[model samples]
Target chain A: MAVYTEIADEELERFLAGYELGALLSVKGIAEGVENSNYLIVTEAGPHILTLYEKRVDPTDLPFFIGLMEHLAARGLTCPQPVRNRAGEALGVLAGRPAAIVTFLEGMWIRRPRVEHCAQVGEALAQLHLAGEGFAIHRRNALSVDSWRPLFQRSEEGADTVLPELGAAILRELDHLEQNWPRDLPAGVIHADLFPDNVFFLKGHLSGLIDFYFACNDFLAYDVAIGLNAWCFEADGALNITKARALLAGYQRVRPLGADEIAALPLLARGSALRFLLTRLYDWLNVPPGALVAPKDPLEYWRKLRFHQSVDDAGAYGMDL
Target chain B: MAVYTEIADEELERFLAGYELGALLSVKGIAEGVENSNYLIVTEAGPHILTLYEKRVDPTDLPFFIGLMEHLAARGLTCPQPVRNRAGEALGVLAGRPAAIVTFLEGMWIRRPRVEHCAQVGEALAQLHLAGEGFAIHRRNALSVDSWRPLFQRSEEGADTVLPELGAAILRELDHLEQNWPRDLPAGVIHADLFPDNVFFLKGHLSGLIDFYFACNDFLAYDVAIGLNAWCFEADGALNITKARALLAGYQRVRPLGADEIAALPLLARGSALRFLLTRLYDWLNVPPGALVAPKDPLEYWRKLRFHQSVDDAGAYGMDL
Candidate 1:
């Protein structure tokens, strides 16, 4: 829960002057996003999200992120459409940070996502992948297989402090992934972080997907792998085959996977697991003193990686090639 | 920014089963309140705040706080009226914490409060005091003069760790206040923590007062003192006489101050300052390891206490006695 920057009434009034959004009724700092300051902005017209991109987000990459939302939104996807000002620009500056207002989507991200929720999310993910077909801009997946080594190196020295065998385990996984990672398959813009938190639902129906900051050009099937790792796991650290089958079946309903994509699922899943594990390990080892956000348990991803290592075929994930 | 407790969608749905509020639309965790987990709950009926009272709040005091809001709102004060569920209960349990749904008031708390804002706050405060005449629930001020010594003792040993002469300075101030603190004044249920953040304004008009957790029986003028300390201080720590005058004048317009209450303003302000200082000092010295909330600067209150010490007359605040 964070609102790192405070926007004053006078400043907000001045900032909204550029937009056709009517009189500001209220502005509340939402504590959802970790990478930016988000406010639920209500105007005389309607509710919108006013986001001030923080230092964690690269200003240059914002065009890709905002443009992706616009592109996908225009393509019949239910995402937050970036509200352009009267001057036809979607982005502006406020409180010394790059800011923009997007139409507020009405849905809650389900916690304890059931099998049906997983299926809805799967369908939404496929829809998002299809919607990105014609987007002009590109953003590279920064936390992909290639970047794991650097992140691992940064956290390696103190990795054992969290767990005795963490450093050695990471090294072994990194070596195995770098050599065996899938090289060729279907690729497009994927929501690299399609965790349950980023997917919203309205009464068992997929309302929309959000947080496009992590969307980038990557193997579209790799996104499916990420979703499998994210959504197919139970609270007890066991894989739920029914949910996995439902999610994959839901996705296939919209866009069927190719034979090569199906064959490469296990390897892609391992790579996806390793990518998250390295990043989490890095964050866990390097959490600054007095940080507002508690570093998530890196061991969770470590266990997920181990499970992926044990799986030798796509059929184990409740899918058949 | 706080949402210590995470409420699951299922848990929330079950909790709302008793409420007549239509199907839930969204619930966004609000990062505003310090002593609770607040979510901006949007349902088919309308917007409301779902607050889970945190550990800092004593569950026994829930009745007083909740009842005060109900009474005040019923008397035409525009505060958050507690929403009763189908069972006609304003408070229930959710996520293992005491929870309630309150009507969502529309307005923003001004960050840089102008004189007009201060005046509105003063008038609203007076209205609140007037409206509270018949409230049956009685809660004693927990941070009043008698409680300061115990709080000071808790932080006394390490007080000098924060500053060289701080420990001795606090003892001296406590000695002065204990000997001369007023025993006779207009006493009533006061909004004991009427900081600027607790007051809301809509388009420069005073909307309402909120956060009744700190409401308790105390000297009526002491609430004014708390407001003066909170609202009259400029960014540079200097007192703004214009704002103070506006606040006091606005209060006088609704409820005229007694001669004794006017005479006791300086001392009450000093006591108010010390009360906050001691609590902040204790918190600053004892912030638990890995605590989500950062301890506020105790020295800010020390500075306010010192400024109040320099004032020889109530006129120094702005209005003529």
Candidate 2:
């Protein structure tokens, strides 16, 4: 976990008292999160990821994650299947922290993401959308544009740093976009973060997708827009043509994009970019110093926000917003 | 708050019974955080950022935050000063969540960050480090290189999408960095996320630095490396020479870089990038459907990791890692 807390091996063993993840080989604490305490756990049952609920995540909502995994695994989605205990619950307490044991996924997150990987991501996302059908639990994409502004308001004090007119500009964009947001498209659960690191590759072929914490059902095409903004944008803040094309074309192969989805692409992509920008902006202003959690570079999202703001139409994203 | 329970404003009013935020004018829900349910509150005390602590932060820790703010504010740090209750407590309860109000900072976050902005940021960070003395509190920069693997392991089960080799590479870098990390230079609390957005600028001058959540007492020089990886990097993943010169020169004017710190620059930058990559990578994999939070672009961090990995010397950052 990103925060500091003492967790001795013996203290942890009690938390795993009834589970069968095999013998605990190691409980190395994970350090790159602001929301949870994670440990790399090696066990006889095999390698598993152990997570202790950190700030922001509700223990009540733990079931959603646990149940989602169970459901996804049953549907053939290659994800970490949560291990159930003797009482049949997949979650438990470890060292007084809400905890769970998740099977380890395998693959290397490529440092140099290639154009083809973008396409592979696009294809995989489409397949995931189709596969997510019939899941028992339900959650709407909580971050659709209607919800974007309120996040900006959280950091209202710092709105003027980059834009002399940030508050007004954001308000105007929200009003305009709200009036123009699209409706009616194939909707289902989506792998929102299709960055190469989230898509596994074993020998250059897609292996298993992991990290379902931000998955949600929304405009299926919005997921596509999110991917485009993420996978197609180059480090210099320029959109890569080959990468964009491959990603779109690959996704289209699995789940054909309708004209409306294409027409809404740019607006949705801007919204997606703003979504990240706003969150990063808030985080940049709020995280306490000397706290264990790492704060993301708020400027990167600012960079992406600038790129999105420059776009006046959907065509910029290789789609028709 | 991204996943707040439906508690009405009036229902949450009682929790505000104790604290004095100076006549709360309005409460607007922020739907994009993993930790706290925040409200943009306008009050007689002025616009304030109101937060209802959700999961990660404890009610007991409120004093630390309150004291932390008071200490920093006392030192001339331009950030939100925590509002306290009649009993000298800066925290209380709101809607069943631990809550408090912080004065809103004013200044817009720049959307399109410029090279000059980097210089301002460098200067501001140095100012922060210099200002963060003992201040009657002690909290470590828990996110030092030692914390990386533990966090990666928590998401390791299926994180092969971005783990294994990345973790190992980071481990090796950590070893090299640990052996050579600067220790004798300046040491103090740092605004680690001194990205352009986190620093408030009134006109061309940096009026304040916001977001001390990741603020910690660490090797002050490492903070500079974090800035280099962030503000000084070009959009193309290469070091932007002008920004690098401006930022470093600006910081040097304030704190003056030491030879050991300069020599350790590459590894420090690599550590910073890897730290972010691991977190972004984990979040990328864990997004669940319908969660309002947008997963950050792991590719961005991945690219950063690659860039840092490619740097063989501290001079790559125009310093001597």
Candidate 3:
């Protein structure tokens, strides 16, 4: 719901001259993506997403993000392929911000993702992990276990205000995780923020995955843990084991989980939960005055973290080692 | 940038059951139209806009607005044509709000409209007035002179806080307008809010007009006044006579202005300024806590009102009476 930079018509026309995208037909600011401004731009050729990287996105990390899309898409994974300009560059400047156009994926992200949708997401996640092999660039997952302490420190002062004793609860969880976090698992590029909104579907089939800004080098099995935390929880903070089994079965069918990865699922799930909980807590505590985007309830992740803490084995997720 | 209603996938599928639009391809909430939740929905047929009318819009006026678009489009005006469902209905309920699908127009609204764009807008506006002649459903202009006082009353208490002596100045202008408001003029369906954003352009030609929520029966020349105030003013609050001349000339070419309509342009412009001023003032003083949409500066309209008050004749607008 952000269009931080407004591209002037003349400037846009000039920018399009460097591309073979044909004449511009329409450009609309889309209410999607929070980190950058996105426009569903239609040219004489077809529809594409025009993204202007805002201050939130580090310009240095864009090559990794854009190139990953290209690499994955070339391997038959459905994702937004960055459109290179005639000058042979995938990125350019528009409206005084780094911008690029990517081919538009044709499907809507399902809201209330059913068991079937979860299975499809699981399969897609595995495919993405496989397709991401041998990427030239490397980016460390900035919001991983190591970043949680500093992130929590920023929000710890006011976390109790949101929920009674929430700060103490978070500190206890963070201490437990910092000491017990898994040190080794199968690692590769993982879409760290593959929420339901980032996965698009059409006719009950997963059409594509989007929002690669959070993709980075992390344990591939940790990606599955993130998906489990995101997709297996019902609105009332209860785990839906049937959907979790379906998602895990779907992923295993594509890329079988190793014994160690299966053994470490609970610990990885706790770390994933803590990652989101800290970030959400930070945002909740630091919402600037007059900010348009409402900070999400941080306690949702708190509930998920507590559930993961209660599970001592992967069997709780309806999966067998 | 508002998508107030989040339509569920199952609900959207059920809603699309009534349309011949083929299978749904994608639906993205678009950041357009302040009064409604608009989505750029693509089905097998093609792109269309799905608008869910919010509470700000009266449900009873749905027929008049939708009917006006259908009538105007059928009469050869380039606007969004309402798409009827299998039941031959253009409006239906979706997400518990009145909703409709309309053909998507291919053009972007110019950010900084030049003289040519102003002229094109003028000609298109004249054509709209002509095309709207035989529309059967008539709606009185809700924000007309008769409503200004009551509207101003809501904001009068804090209007001075926005600017020095602003409330007193508004009262004086309201008195003058009520005493000398034009009683007789060529009246018809006018696009009462024809700001640049409502007028789209493609390759430098006006492609279409949109946002018909404010359409109602009003003085045709009054619409022209709104266009002039909207399109012919510079960023620094000075009038651009060249653009104003071009807009008026273009309108004259399509349908000649009557002598009375020409004579009343200055006063109509003043009333138009006041209309926008009072509304903006109300919004400025009454912005709801945590509201996403920022209220536009009310004093911008105040400056325009002052300029209109200083003009004594139509010549100031570059039109000869």
Candidate 4:
């Protein structure tokens, strides 16, 4: 829920002059994205989303995000297609920030995601990974294993303030992940943050995946691991094996996991959980001023990490080896 | 920018079950309204605005607000028409808040409004007042003169902290307003808060007026005065008499202003300015916790009040009285 920058009507008209899309009918700031100022813009042509890239997003990495959308849309993936201006540029400046327009996708994310939703998301994630095969640009995953320790270090001092054993638990997990992090699993462009909110569904079907700011080249299997943690967990922090089996089955139907990938799933799942826990811990400790969102409890990820620690292999996730 | 309540997907589906709007497709929280959780919901039927009334709005006034929109829309005004469910109820409970769906009006509020925009708004407002003539429901303008003293008292102690002479000036103005306030005028339902953002324009024509939460029974001329202050003020706090004249002229074309109404415009304008100034002062002093919007500078209203103070008559607004 943020509109960090506001575009004046005159400025918006001037900006839209470069686009073939018809006159701007409306621009309603969407209380969705936290990393950017987003507006649900309507024009004579159709409804679209106008986003102003904020300081948090690296301008240099924008090309990768935009290009990935274009590539995915071109490959028949259901994602927002960047609407290029008449000058043929999809990205430009608005209100002193990099801005772009994308065609609006019509769907809502399910809060209480059923096992079927997990299965559908798994298929979509596999499809996204497959679709990225021919894309040229690459963005390194910034919150990957290598960055975890440094991120955890920032919150390490007062981490116990959140929970008595939180700091030591994170330190131990970081050490374990550092020593055992898989290096040779299959890699491709992964929507590093495929949270439920980013995945839209319509009429009980997955419509699209959005928010490509975190998309990057990472272990494709790690992406699967991330999805496992995100989609297969209930509110009580318990793993739903039925949803997990459905998710993995749906993924394997598109791109089967190799023996090494299967072997590495548990460790990668733990690493994914630890990665999120560290970042959530940091945000939980130091909420930025004027943050519109409440800090998600870091302990949520801590619980997930503990569950992953108990898992011996992918088979524990209801996968029959 | 506000989404005070988070609606679960399941709850939304169940709520929409009573509506004829077909299956729910998408729900995007709009960062526009300050007093409600508003979502641009789209279903098979089409796009509509779903408003979850926040605590700031009185539940008893829901009937008035919803009824006013329905009445205005039926009178051919291009505003959001409250959509009734199959049960014929326009308002219902969603996420423990009063919620309603209204037909989505397509138009954008001009940021830098021109004279033509002001003129169009003037005509539209006059039409709204006339259309609201037979409205059975009555909502007292809670921010009317009788309430200003109490509102000011809440912020009076810290008012001068915002400006050097702000506190004393407001008290002085309040005394003047309460003494000289017009006793008898053409009273009707007025869109008391006809600010620029509430009026929408498309292709340089006023398409609709919105946000009827502030609409109430008041001196019809006061509505004109509010619009004059809102739409005729330049960014530098200077009054644009040409715009003001166009606005008044536009209104006069629909329903001629009586001698008393014409004479009362200046004082009403001053009162309108003060009303907003006091509320803004209160909000400026105390922005709610986790507020998504920055408190607008109360001094802006103070400057407007000072400008209104200097005006001697309606002629100062370019009307040849």
TM of chain B, each: 0.98, 0.87, 0.98, 0.98
How well does candidate 4 match the true structure, expressed as C-alpha RMSD? 2.0
| Best of the candidates, lDDT | 3
> Candidate 3 docking category?
medium
For B1-321, candidate 1 gives per-residue lDDT tens digits of 434688988899999888999899988987687788888999998899999998889999999999999999899999999999999999999999999999988888999999999898899989999999989989999989999999899999999999899999999999999999999898999999999788888888988788998999999999999999999998788899999999999999999999998899999999999999998898889877666677788888888999999988899998776
Better of 2 and 3 by DockQ: 3
DockQ of each: 0.76, 0.01, 0.79, 0.66
Lowest summed lDDT over 10 consecutive residues: which window, candidate 4 chain A? A1-10
lDDT of candidate 3 over B133-185, digit per residue (tens): 99999899999999999999999899889998999999999999999999999
**Interface RMSD in angstroms for candidate 4:** 1.7
By descending DockQ, how would the candidates be arranged?
3, 1, 4, 2
How do all models score by TM-score? 0.98, 0.49, 0.98, 0.95
Q: What lDDT score is found at residue B121 in candidate 4?
A: 85
What is the clash count of model 3? 0
lDDT by residue (tens digit), candidate 2, A1-321: 235444644456666667866555434443323467665555556456777776566676677667877787887878778987778888888667788888866554444568878888888888888778887777766677777877778887887775677667667777877887887776887766666556666546677787676777788888888888778877787888688888888998998888777777777787777777777678667766434434556556656766776776666656422
TM match of model 3 to true structure: 0.98
Which parts of model 3 are misplaced by more than 4 Å? none
Which candidate order results from sorting by lDDT in descending order? 3, 4, 1, 2
What lDDT does each candidate get? 0.89, 0.68, 0.92, 0.90
**Candidate 2 DockQ score?**
0.01
lDDT by residue (tens digit), candidate 3, A1-321: 433577889999999889998999999988778788899999998999999998878999999999999999999999999999998999999999999999999999988988998898889999999999999999999998888999899988998898999889888988888898888889999999999889999898999999999999999999999999899899999999999999999999899999999989999999999898888888888877656566788889989999999998999998975
